[model samples]
Structure formats: structure tokens, C-alpha cells
Target: MYEFFRDLDRRWIFLMMFLCVAVPIIIIGATGKTFPEEPTQLVRAVFDEIENLPSGSKVLLSYDYDPASEGELAPMATMFAYHCAAKGHKMYFMALWPVGPQMVDDTIENIIKKDFKDLKYGEDYVNLGYKSGYEGVIKVIITDFTELYSTDTRGTPWSAIPMCHDVNSVQDMDLIVNVSAGYAGTKEWVQYAVTPYPKLRMVAGCTGVQAPLLYPYIPQQLHGLLGAIKGAAEYEALVIEAYGDKMARKDAGDNPLTDDNGDYLIPGKYTEGIRRMGPQLVAHLLMILLIIVGNVIYFVERRREGRR
Candidate 1:
């Protein structure tokens, strides 16, 4: 058994990894069971920041990420849009990355337009679209929104949009929530927007690698943060727990069915980040087990050679 284990084929290891990932994913897809997420301080802060805001507050959502990092950032973006819309906040969407506008559009389609049909385009939310210039755009919009943005993404003049008529600059926003991947992202916002405008309240959801870099700015430059998918998962759990009943009631109207606790039903998609965690946990465990097994085989083989 020891000899066979020491000489294990590479293909067998690949097969084990394949099973580790695929089995959990298939089980989760069918049963909808996900690993439970406990809200970390960072995630809790993000949830509270949005929750504490008054209804109809103005929020600026900067999508500074592209599809390349969408898998990590999109879940939080979806939750952000949903939470703001549910809380009756007026959302102003803009992107620093060229493909960022598409990300915003996808969120609107999936979360806003699909879930909250009553939200009017220019009234409840407005898409300012993507603009050129890396941090240069952030610098310009920090003080003068009109100088950089005279029209929405679709070519409609800002004069036609009701939301744009009242805004003068980024400072006019009550809160700024940014979902970003890398450069021209959270760092740019902290420098160009929050740094210059100290009063501006900002929360950000960024890739895992960027989280540590931004930690020093917490509670000062950044009000809250969601770091990578783990942060997204925790935040998603918090939002769902707080707002699930409200969503169920809204969707079902009068005489909606409730669970034992009287909370209404919510869609499965709301817990997507959590659901993905199941596969992640299983894959990680499998990797750890494989490492232990490999090390054991190495030591056993080394001992046998020494004895011979």
C-alpha cells in the first residue's frame, strides 16, 4: 500500500481534484445548500453604512472593474444595487473602466429592472456611463460633475435626466459605494475623491489582494469595505437576513406566505455568494488533504530508502 501510494499517478491526483470541485458544485446546484457565512467587522460595516442611510438618499456607485474580475466583484455589486434600491435610494451609476458601464447595465438588468420594476430609469437611478482618463476623470468629477459628464451613457443630454439636473459634483452624493478590481479603482477613489473631500462617506468592495492596502484608511477615508468573495458572501448574508422579509412582502403583496419566524420568501439568487462558498470550502479541504497525503508518502519513501 505504501509503495503504491508513493508511486501514485499524476492523472489520479487530477481526478481527485476534479471530484473535489465538481461533486460539491453539483450537490449545491441541486440542494441549494451553502456554507454559512458569519459577518466580519468589515462586512458588517458595509451593511450598516447602507442601512443607516435615510430613504431617498443619493448614492454614487462607481464600477471601476471589468469582466475579467467580475466573478469576484459582481456579487457585491448586485447586493449593493439591490440594497440601495430596496432602501429607496437614488442611484447614480458611473464607471472608470471602459467596460465598467456594461457591468452596471448587467446589475441593473438582474437586480433593479428585474426585481424592482417600479424604479424609473432617470428618476430612481441614472447611468452616467464610462469616461476616459484614469484618475483624471475622478479628479475632474470630484469637484465638477458637469465638466466631465454632460450626458448619460446612451447619448441623452444630462439636461433631460431629472437626477442629473440636481447634481453639481460627487460631493453632492450622500454616499459613494465602489466595486473595483485594481488600478483606477478603490485606490483612485480614496486619493481623488475621499482624500480631497474629507466629509465624503465612502464604502468599497475590492479584490482580495487590494483589501490589505486599503485597511489603513478604514473609518477615515473609507467608511466600510467588502474584500473579495469572502467579504461579498458575508455582506450578502447580512443584507438577506435584514431585508428578506421586506423583499418577500413587496413581491407577494397582500397575504404572502411566511416561514415560522414570519419572514417572507426571497429568491435563491440573493444568496449566490454564500452558495459558491460550498464549493470553495470543499476544494480547499481537498487540497489540504492531498498535501498531507503527499507529505506522508514522501516521508515513508524516504525512510524505506534510508533503511535499504
Candidate 2:
């Protein structure tokens, strides 16, 4: 038995892992069921910070990412936009990377434009677009916004936008929310913006590799963080649970899952992070089982040697 187990083919292990991942994903898609997730203090802090803010609070959202990382960070961006809009916060959008502007625009189109059509541009929300200064932009904006941005993304003068009138500098913002991918992102914002203006509160979401580097700043220089997809997934569960209940109550007679037009109302995009979590959970369990089996085989072989 030990010889057969020890000589198990690598191909069999690979096949098992493949099934372990694929089967759960297929089941989740068909049934629309996901593993339950409890929000950690890290994620809860982020939610509470936003939730506690007064309605109509000024929020600056910096999109320092590009399309390549959209898969991991998009869900987080959507939740941030949705939550802010739902909370009646005035959202000011901007970016550091040149491609960052497009990411900001995508969030507006997908989340704000689609679901919250009542939100007027330049009033409830405005996009300042991409500025070329990188971290230098953060430093300047910390003190003066109009110095770099005299106009919103559309080329309209800042004076023309009602919201811009109130935002002379980054300090005027009630909160700084950033969803970043790489260099000139969270680190730059931390060093240039938040560090100097200790009174300014901030929260952020970043790719997995960047989380550890940013963790040291949490609950102090940085108020809260969504570390990666897992953190995003946990946050998603909390937001959906709250929002879903509110929607259901409003549509008391009709299906909460669908709009008045009989079309599906709940955007599937909102659930991306949570949906992906199902397969990840199964894959991790399979890995742990494989490790246990491997260790058992090693011990059995050692016992055989001792008998000899």
C-alpha cells in the first residue's frame, strides 16, 4: 500500500486539482450560491468609516490603475462608487497614471451612470481626469487643486463645475478613497498626501502583492484597507447584504432581483469578487488535503525503513 501510494503519478495529482477547481466554479455558476464570508476588522473598518460619514461628504477617488489589473480591482471600484452614491456623498474622481482616467470613467459609466442616474455630473460627482505629475500631483493637490486642474476631465473650466467651486485643495475633501495597482499609487498617496495632512482621513484597495507593503500604514496613517480580492470579496458580502435588503423592501410587490421593466436589476458585476471566492475556497481545501496525503505517505515510508 505504501509503495503504491508513494509512487502515485503526478498526472493524477494534477487532474485532481483541476477537478477540484472546475467543479466548484461550475456548481456556483449554475446554483448562484457562494460560500459565506465574515468581514474581518480590516474590512469592517473601511465600511464603518464610509458609513459613519455625514451625507454629502466630499470624497476624492483616485484611480491609479489600468485595464490589465481591472479584473482584480474593478469589483472594489464598483463597490466604492455604489456605496458613495448610495450614501449621498459627493464623489470627485481623478487619476495619477495616464490610463487611470479611463478606469475612473469606466466606474462612472458602469456604476453611477447605470444605477444612479439621478446623480448629476458636476453636482453629485465630477471627474478631474488624469494629471501627469504622478506623486508630484499628490503633493500639489494636497495644498491646491486648481493649480493643476483648472478644468474637469471634459475641458470645462473648474469654475463652471459646481462641486469644483468648493474644492480649492485636497484638504477640503472629507475623505480620500484610492483604488490603486502599482507604482505612483497607494505608496505615493501615503507619502505625499496623507502623511503631511495628518488630519485627512483615507482608505484604499490594492492588488494582493501590494497589500503587505501597505498593511503597516493601516488604522493610523491609513484608516482602512481592502488588501486584495479576498478583502474585496468580504467587503462585497457586507455591502450586498445591506443594499439587497433595502432594495427588496422598496420593491415590496415586485421581484427585488428585477427592475420595473422586468429586466434583472441586480448587476452581476457587483458580485464578481464574491463569485470568484467560491472556486478559490475549494482550490485551497484541495491543496491542504494534498499536503496531508503527502505527509502521511512520508511517515509510512519511514516506518517501513525502521522495520527493515
Candidate 3:
């Protein structure tokens, strides 16, 4: 057994790791099923902030990541948009990163355009698109929005958009939902917008590595936070659990019954974060097993060498 383990090809371990991730993904994708999640306090706080908002409340969604971090960040973005749309909040989409606008568009297309078709653009929601000044843009917009954003992404004047009619600055927003991957993201919003205006409520979702750095601002500058895909999964679970049946009824035009296992027939797009967690969980377990096996082999060989 010692010799066998010692001689085990590195390629075999690589194959095991690949299978560990791929199999769960395939199963979850095919079945539309995902492992259950228990939301952390921070995740629940994010859900509560959006849930507690009255219908028709104005919400500003800042997408601060690009395609490179989409795999980690997009799920939360989609969930945030979906939750706000379902709650009947008026959304104002904008970005600090150059490619952030595209992320906003993608979320709108996938969630609002696809599921909630009754929502009208420029009234219920508007895409303000990307701005170039980073934190500087946040600093300006906190006081006077028109100082920078005079037009929406489609070249329509901000004055023309019904949603922007009463908006003078970011202070007008009932809540701010920010999804960020790096610099000039949640930190910038917290510093330039929420910190200065204590009444301006904010919540954020960020990459796993960035979560720790932003925790200090929570409950004060940031109302809540979602960290990486795990955080996204937890938030998604909360939203689906609360609103899935209502959404199903909306689609079927009547009350819809649960599936055989007592689950709502929610769309796959809404479950992206949950589905992603399956592979992540499996991959982590596989890595732990591999580490244990490697250590056993190392110790066994050392003992043999000492005896000889």
C-alpha cells in the first residue's frame, strides 16, 4: 500500500479533482436541485433590508465587477436584481468599472426582462450605465447626480427618464445595493457615499478575498454583505424560499402547487448560486481528502527510512 501510494501518478489526482467538481455541476444542472444553505447573519441582514423596503422604493444597484470576476460575483448581482424587481422597487443601475454596465445589462436581461416582463423601463427601472471617475464619481453623485449622469445608457436624458425626475442625488435612493470585485467598488461606495451620509442605507456583495476587509463597515456604513458565491447562495436561498411560490403563481396565472418533494418550480437562472455551491462543496472535500492521503504517505515513508 505504501509503494502504491508513493507511485500514484499526479495525473490521477488531477483527474480525481476534475471529477469532484464536474460531477456535482452536471447533476445539479440536470436536476435543477442544489444543496440547501443556512444563511449567515450577514446574509440574512441583506435579505431583510431589501425585503423590508416598501414597494416603489427607489434602489440604486451599482455593479462594480467585470466578466473576469463574473463567475464569483454575477450570481449575487442577479439575485439582488431579482429580489428588488420582485419587491416592486424602482431600480437605478450604474457602474464604476468600465465593463460594469454590461454586467448591469446582463442582470436586467436575465432577471427583469425574462421573468418580470410587466415592469416598464425608464419608470420602474433605468440603466445609468458606466462612469469613468471611480471613487471620484461617487464623491460627486452623492451631492448632485446630474453633475455627472445627465443621460441613461440608451442616450435618453436623465430628465426624460420618469424614475430620475425627483432624484437630485444618491441621497434620494431608499437603498443602495452594490456588487463589487475589487478597487473602487464597495469600499468606495462606503467611504464616499454611505460614510458621509449615515442615513443612506447600503448593502454589498464582494469576492471572498475582499469580504474580510469590508466587514468593519457593516451595520453602519454597509447594512449587510454577501461574500463570494457562498454568500450569494445563502441570499438566493432566502429569496427563493420567501417568494418562489408567488412567482410560480404569477407564471402559471393561478396558484401553483409544489413539486413532489415539496419544492417550488423555480427557474434555473434564479438558482445559479445554489447550484454552484454543490461543486464547490465537493471540490473542497476532495482537496481535504487528498491532503490527508498525501500526509499519510509522507509520514509512512519517513518511518520506513528511519527503521532502515
In model 2, pairs of residues that clash are: none
Best model number under lDDT: 3
The order by descending lDDT is 3, 1, 2
lDDT of 2 by residue, 1-308 (tens): 65766898999888988988789878978976777779999898888888889999999999899999898898899899888998999999999989988899899998889878899999999999998979999988899998899899899999999988877899999999999899889988889988988999999999999999999898788899997789899888878776764333235565466556553344567888888887778878988988998999989878989999
What C-alpha lDDT do the candidate models reach, one value each? 0.88, 0.86, 0.92
The prediction achieving the highest TM-score against the true structure is 3
Evaluated at residue 120, the lDDT of candidate 3 is 97
Worst 10 residues of 1 by lDDT: 248-257
Instruction: Write down the TM-score for model 2.
Output: 0.84
Write candidate 1's Cα lDDT for 105-199 as tens digits.
Answer: 99999889888899999999999999999899989998889898999988888889997778889999999999989999998899999998898
In model 3, which range of ten residues has the least summed lDDT? Answer: 247-256
Residue ranges of candidate 2 with Cα displaced over 4 Å = 1-22, 246-266, 286-308
In model 3, what lDDT does residue 21 have? 85
Instruction: Mark the regions of model 3 whose C-alpha exceeds 4 Å error after superposition.
Output: 1-10, 249-254, 297-308
Better lDDT candidate (1, 2): 1
Candidate 2, which ten residues in sequence have the lowest lDDT sum? 245-254
- Report the candidate with higher lDDT, 2 versus 3: 3
- Candidate 2 at residue 209, lDDT? 92
